[model samples]
Target chain A: MSLSPLGASRSLAAVFLPIKSGGLVDEVCRRIELAVETGLLTSGQRLPNEIELAGALGVSAVTTREALSQLRGQGLIRTVRGRSGGSFIADDALPSPERARARLLDLTRLQISDLGLHWRAIAATCAGVAARRSDAADIASLRGYIRPAAGDGQGATALAWRLSASEFMLEVAAVARSARLAREILRLQADMGTLTLLPFGDPAFCEHIAELSEAVTAAIESHDSGAAEARTRELIQTTTNWLLAEHAAGQAHTPGTTEEEAS
Target chain B: MNGNDAAPATAELRTLVEGIEGRIDDWAAATTRWLNDAGKLSGSAIDKFVRPTVSDMLLAPGSNVTGAGFIASAGLLGPDRSYIAWWQGEDLERVDALANFSPQSMSRYVGAEWFKVPVATRRPHVTGPYIDLLCTDEYVLTFTHPVFRGDAVAGIVGLDVTAQTLERRALPLLRRIGPRAALVSAGGRTIVCAAPDVDAGDVIGPAEGAAATPIGRSFTLLAAAAVA
Candidate 1:
């Protein structure tokens, strides 16, 4: 079960790559993503035997198999057993929104600013593609997501409404019809939502949502693809900055409270 | 009274015979042209003709025809009959018959074995004059020509000629020709037989003596000199 040269190269490239260590399973997921991105594997391309891949990666066959299974659960790969059968990449495989969200959450725990910068770049590109391809009906469907906040709303409901406002922007990404863009948007939104959920009591959050909704709608209605994309990126960055500032202020107050307790 | 009655009957029979004689002449002319034109075209040109004709015929009748391309490679020999590119029409169900008739298969029908014999072995071959098992009433005539691209014999192009419909339209003339005309492939496979009783599975071999005389010849005569 010696590994092929191609498999060995892929294995070396994916290991200890400065990403979070989720153990063997997470490492396999990273490798699969890298393989897809680099075009080493394409849709419908078959993977080597489990034993071969394990030997190449210098890991036990059982660990490699479990990693492959985890990748399958994420809709990244599929396995077929029997004669004339093996694991293959699904032609129409797209990461689920939940998986995207998990990845974003993992990134946010390390650095919010860096995540915001990446989100801006990705969303801008999506907006351009959506504007070029989307018809009037697609724009109308996006408008349906916007609704006024309910009176006397508290906690999750208010947060939910704010999140719903983000859909106008998300709809732009959807129209691009790029699976990669959609997955990345879902990841960014998930991370942003998680961070903002704690600070919803602040009035600035609601005001920021209102501004974002107006800017996105105006750009989209004008049929300006570039403007729409730029507006989306700007809004996301602004929101991220606001959340980071709030988190830092909270951290400062926590230290003061701790000193008082010690005294 | 008997003489007078016989005269009228005789007169009617004469007119019918004359009409049949005229149709036979027309069929002979048409068949000659069909054979000549089909033989002159290259394999690629024939395939081009088949694609459009088959597509129009199948789609016009509201049947979904899919997976069109030439059959090649060993992997195509699946249970689903993926070898033949074109799949629509009454011949769809005849996959089993075709499989059986294939020389590779043991259950080959009477004329089927002769048809499978390579064109090289049956020089100046003419097939058919036999009924298709699937379409029991309609006779299909195939004119097969050796396909060559460069120095190789790639395959053969078999053009389906519907003899039953042709006979109906030119029946009056065909009747005068003894209704025994056959359209055969180069491999000696009888593609269309006017006579209903002819078994397709029987070895047709080579035409002999006066029987070799084409009554209503339409196919283009292959230049015997050209086939090396």
Candidate 2:
């Protein structure tokens, strides 16, 4: 069930229940998360007035106000007042990696192989552009992005390294000076970010990021656009294949299906 | 010059003049009533009556009066001047005369450079009692109604009435009834003046009394009552 942009949900009140069953502020935060996850809300979209939202949710305006304040504190939303003002989603609020993973799983329901194919196509284009266009300043920015992983151990180091690699790719896209290409890269990164949240627990994912980063850096340094593009595609495919194998093995152990049905 | 010799001839001429005047008055009165009742004066309707009745009278030999009618928008008459619907009479004379007294014309009287204020900052308005710089022989009064379509104000409906004409026709009755009147736009610019000596700017403020209702864009009746 993909969420519509119009904020329609099957059970609006039920969506808010988890937060209500917790603390008042906590409830608002929970509901906001649900709203974003279920596509009942979007970045930079305005919410109704506090009084209106409270009335609809069967809560006091004060409670609604407190919840809004808490959401603002968490940098999730912002409020504007006056004749044409209302609460709006903050432009910068991307959820934590774990939450993003959950959202991606809910939306895509994709096998690892499919995810890999999509990433390879996206990363190859991004890398080719980066190799062709990147200058000294771009390399410096990319190096800054990876610096946090330098002294860290394997798992923690890998997460930082992968996040930096994503940021580097995004920066490269921005340098490409084509808004359309940049936007496409950003969308791919967002989807990929969601998929990697829980899967970061795997050490092989970390090793893959390190290897891909080295390949990308070498290609970028050599100004070899083809090699950069190839390496990025290879990295994405490798990760994707591992995830597909894991999914297939999990399905094979399930009770109801035969091997043919599982496949 | 002999009274007895010319008495019958003079009497016959006087009778003819009186009859013509009576018919002109009747025609003007009927048109006024129709315009007031309809709350709008369409060009087609004006074309049907104005030339045959009002224009013919004004154009009559020895009358020394040449009058025209025009449908004005955005402070200028519509472009089709040759069309009876667009003819404003006597070419540029009447047009220039009226334009000099229009709200855009009077914006110079006050230091304001514009007639209609933008809607974002507009307040309900009424303005009058300014002398028209053009058409020095007669005073003029204008009633402007702002027309709004949806959330935005589109334009104004302006009723331009010559003060000399109104004084000759309706002033006696208006004075007797002691009716205080003004013309205002949606943004409240006073387009013309009835009392030339008085300040039109002062007369125009927020539309008070009955003018607040949102009527059609081009026509609105502020308040109407029997003058008796």
Clashing residue pair totals per candidate (backbone < 3 A): 33, 7
Could you tell me the interface RMSD of model 1? Answer: 25.7
Residue-wise lDDT of candidate 2 within A47-131, one digit each (tens)?
6667756644446788888888888887889887788888887886644554544444344336455656766776678678667
Off by over 4 Å in 1: A1-10, A13-110, A148-156, A256-263, B1-228
**Segments in model 2 whose C-alpha atoms lie over 4 Å from true places:** A1-112, A147-162, A257-263, B1-228
DockQ of each: 0.01, 0.01
Model 2: CAPRI class: incorrect
Candidate 1, A1-263: lDDT as tens digits: 88998999888988857874458767656666654532335578677667756644546788778888887887778888789889888776523334333433344324878777888888888777666555554567566655433542334354445545555556666555454576677667655644544433455566566577567666766668878788888777776776566555555555566478679
Q: In model 1, how large is the Cα lDDT of residue B179? A: 44
